[model samples]
Target: HRFGITFHRNKRSKAAINTELETIPGIGEKTVIELLRHFRSVSKVKKASETALSEVIGPAKAKIIIKHYQQTTNEN
Candidate 1:
């Protein structure tokens, strides 16, 4: 059914997002869950301000995540 296909696609996308989050050093499963629960997607996470991210994962980790994404963005 079309609904089944849509569900599978959503699941796949969520997994891909999780995989990308996992690649960030010092971020583990718990932090990934927290990020996803709060931001819902990697795109949202990337756009989130440091204070916003700190609300979910604390200031120290938020800076690290922001720095990591900024570095990756600069490299590209």
Candidate 2:
């Protein structure tokens, strides 16, 4: 007889999860704080549409946030 082992992964929301969102390329504490201030949560930040993010973060930083979210989602 043969046996196999299996593993389980946790599927938690980004906002509830305490990931180091500040570590994303081009993001820092200030930007992170600003994002949190405007969005109030990581899930909201991650889910924000480009235009909405741009309105809150400005064009350059908004692009970075968008890229970070895309990259993080891909990693998950």
Question: Each candidate's lDDT (Cα)?
Answer: 0.89, 0.73
**What residue runs in model 2 are displaced by over 4 Å at the alpha carbon?**
1-19
Which window of 10 residues has the lowest lDDT sum in candidate 2?
1-10
Model 2 lDDT tens row, 1-76: 1222222222223334444667787877667777788988888888889899888778888888788778877999
TM-score of each: 0.75, 0.65
Cα lDDT over the full model 2: 0.73
Error of 1 at 24 (Å): 0.7
Error of 2 at 41 (Å): 0.4
Estimate, for each residue in 1-76, the C-alpha lDDT of model 1 and write its tens digit.
9999999999867656545778889988789888988898888999999999999999999998999999999999
Give the Cα error of residue 28 in candidate 1, in Å.
0.6
